[model samples]
Target: MFNKIVLENGLRIVTENIPYVKSVSIGIWIEIGSRFENQSNNGISHFIEHMLFKGTENRTAKQIAESIDSVGGQLNAFTSKEFTCFYAKVLDEHLPLAVDVLADMIFNSKFNEEDIIKEKNVVFEEINMYEDSPEDLVHDLICQTMFDGHPLAYPILGSSSILEKINKKNVLDYYKQYYTPNNTVISIAGNFDTDKTIELIYKYFSNWIPVKKEKDEQCPPMFYRRIMGKTKNTEQLHLCLGMKGVPQGTNEMYHLMVLNNIFGGSMSSRLFQKIREERGLAYSIYSYPSSYKDTGMFTIYVGLNPNYVSTVLQLITEEIDKIKNGGMTSDEIYKSKEQLKGNYILGLESTSSRMSSMGKSELLHGKIYRPKEILEMIDSVQREDVENIAKEVLDFNRLNISFVGDINNNQIESNFKKIIG
Candidate 1:
């Protein structure tokens, strides 16, 4: 069972005690993300994530890495448009130490000027690296186009022009505005004493004051989403399509997950069985759903020869029409439910996954739902529910598509015609 504790200072701690496991995964989830920024401060959240490792007031970046390495533990962090997390997986013997290190990086980083300059270039190079990978590029396009002009449209790895202008003061200012006790959740999983663990967190974080900041400036609703990005060549064509979907905490959210699983999400899904196994159109094809606090999207991605790009899009639309008109089978419904259960159960093996689960659920829903509860929720979804979601969501007229590859602009226009036709 997992236990939760809300601190006096407003930091929430979530923990699970698995006695059989000898390791613990701890994560600090800050609610703020790239969406909290304007164009001037874009990418600062990610840049600050990098800076956290460069050193704390008491530890150098190398010492931090070496300390974790010396103990055979792993320390890492990531930033997304919706949240940023710093996590550590350490042996149970070092749980207290891990908590100290993580809390320090989050609450007391010095943001050194020298390290800031070097990490800036590193982020720029990271952006270059993404330009070389079509899969990442096209998905970025999907997100940017799907939520055009909203903060969601901006890439997590902001452009070099903005990263170049990013500075230590700006990063620290962003951190101050958002990384507060009220805005953070601490998730810890695996063998540990609940009381002692909470004590460790309270001991470290108690002195930190809660911060209140101005609300993020709102943007208008997005429509007719499209990403037209230009870059150097790649072999295969990468294409992504998305339609606006439901937000979290709704009945429609459950149905959308089931709908995506049947259409193109699974290995047995219609898109996979038809496009890859049957037609030999691509090596990989799948769909997934992503939900933020207020909004969500259902997206499909495929890679194929630049020549057959049009055919792939047509097949995808055909499958969408099939699901929208006819609905899913008992067999697809059962298989997808089983797949969902299997993935959730398998995730329990890792402390990191559990930590993330605990944090995000609490952050988004103000509650923690166990794995068993989630599987049951998935299992309870019916074929009728899946079909209803498809009818409401899969509108060819409202679809958004993004392409990133070495192809003629005419092909892009042809894609639009085929979808609309």
Candidate 2:
């Protein structure tokens, strides 16, 4: 179970007490990321995430890392399309240490001018590294093609040209605008006294004044039929087919998950079994749904030899059509529901997963459901629900196709036109 308390400053502290565990996981989730950024300062959120660990008022870069390492604790952070999280996992006895260290990084980071200059090179190399990996780069291209002219299409890593001009002042200014107590959630889970943990967090974060700033209101990204092909010297063709999907917290999302699982989410899924196991058309192929605050995307990725691209796309298209037209069997629906429930339960067994779940639920939805509630929701999904969602979200005509490999543009255009038309 989880409990939450909203502080006077508008910060929320949510915790789950797991008596059986000896470790606790804590995270600070900020409800802003690359999507909130405009074109000029696109990657600053990710950049600031890195700068937070460089040095604080009292701890040097080395000391901050050593403080956690010396105690056998894990400390890390990640930036996503709509949010950023700085988290740490440590022994329950060291909960205070974990909280203090994270607080320091969040509140006292220097964002030094010299460090900004050096980290820009590091981020640039990181961008180049992704460009060299076609499989990874293709996913970004898919989003670019789907959301042609929106901020959502901007790469989370920003662009080399933009980063080159960003200075310390720019990063600090952006950080101040978004990183407020009201805009953040502190989540902790594991064996600990709830009152004590809350007190510790309050001690570290209470002094900060909450700010009132207007959040950027973004219109949902419109989807269109687009085919983007980038010719590169690669061994296999990396292709992604995607369409616009439901937003977070929508009722249809549950049906969409079940639909995706039966279609391509697991090894027993239609795409994996038919494409990889049965016909040996591709070594990697699967489908996933990405839901954000206002909108989402449903995408399928495949990496196969250039000779197999045509066959693979055809098979994938056939599988989707089959699911949409005929719907999945009762057995498939039962198994998928069971698999989803079991995985959701097993995932919460870890302190880290529980902490993350609590944080995201509160931040994204403004409410968190108990495991029983979630399982019930999953069990309530019927075959018709899945079929209805599939029909609404899956359309061959209104889809985007992105490919990265040694494939000519004319070749892609011809093949896609034949199938989509």
Candidate 3:
């Protein structure tokens, strides 16, 4: 069961209480990330995420870490394109301490001048590390090519030029604007008394004042069907193909998941079977769907021998064409639905996973779906739905291709256009 309450200030508190489990996972989900940023302030969300742990007024950075560690608890945080979360998992009894630490970090963290400079250098190294890995870098390249001029294309780690430009004032101002109680959600799952947890949350969070900020709706992403490549001395060519997809919180979103599973989401998927198992053309191949508040991306990734890029690209196009033209059978539809249902159910068994699901749902949709509700949604997908979505989204003419490897520009331009045409 899910329990939810919204504070007067608009902070949302959602919880799931599992009686059998002795552990509890708590997450503070903020409704701000890279998507809310522009070129000048890119990566500020992620940078502020790191800065939160540096220290709070009442707790030194080391003390903050030790407080959680001493209780045999775990604390961590992550920043995504749309949101940032700071979470802690501990024994049920430590829920109060966890709440206190999280609230303090959000409300009282001092973005120190000296610490800002140090973390800036650290983020610089993180950017360099990504540049060193071509496989990882290609995804960013694909995003840049696919989204083009949109803010969605901006790198989450940002660039060295922008990082150097960001300072304490920028961090503080951004945090003040977006870290209001109204822009936050606190989610907990696993063992807890619902009423007691609610009281505890109010105790820690009630005093934080809300800010008046205008709701900013993102402009629908304008996708460019671009074929871009970078030459790098890598062992194998890393290829990524992407197309615009349905946004989050839509009926088509579920159908797209079912479609991706049959196409390349798993080892039994068409791309994996055709490209890896049967032909042995690539060691790694898969497809995934990324849905945001207002836009989405369906992407297929493959790492293969540079010599076989043309052949692999041809086969990929063929499979995509086949699906668009009714390659998905009733059997494939049934199995993929079953697979999606099983995965969704199995994933919910963990407290952390439940916390994350509820947090995202509440922040994004203002509502949460229970296990049975989601399973029903998965079951409702049919063969025609998959085919229709594929036909609408899988046009070769609208595809974006990104490649990184030791390959020449002429080889890429000629071969990609030939296949795409």
lDDT tens string, model 1, 113-140? 9989999989999999998888998898
User: Lowest-lDDT window of 10 residues in candidate 2?
Assistant: 412-421
lDDT of 3 by residue, 1-421 (tens): 6899999999999999999999999999999888789989899999999999999899989989999999999999999888999999999999999999998898888888988998899899999999988889889888888888888888888899998998788988899999999999999999999999999999989888999999676688887678778999999999899898888988899999999999999999999999999999999999999898888988999999999999999999999888988777999999999999889888977899999999999999999988988988899987888888999788766789888999976887788888876
RMSD of 2: 1.0
* Model 2: CA > 4 A from native: none
Q: lDDT per model, in order?
A: 0.84, 0.90, 0.91
Candidate number that wins on lDDT, 1 or 3: 3
lDDT of 2 by residue, 331-411 (tens): 999999999999998998899999998899899889988888888889999998999999888987778999999998789
Off by over 4 Å in 1: 217-220, 225-227
Q: How many backbone clashes can be found in candidate 2?
A: 0
Highest-lDDT candidate: 3
Q: What range of 10 consecutive residues in model 1 has the weakest lDDT sum? A: 223-232
- The clash count of every prediction, one per candidate, is 0, 0, 0
RMSD score of candidate 1 (Å): 1.6
Query: Judged by lDDT against the true structure, how good is candidate 3?
Result: 0.91
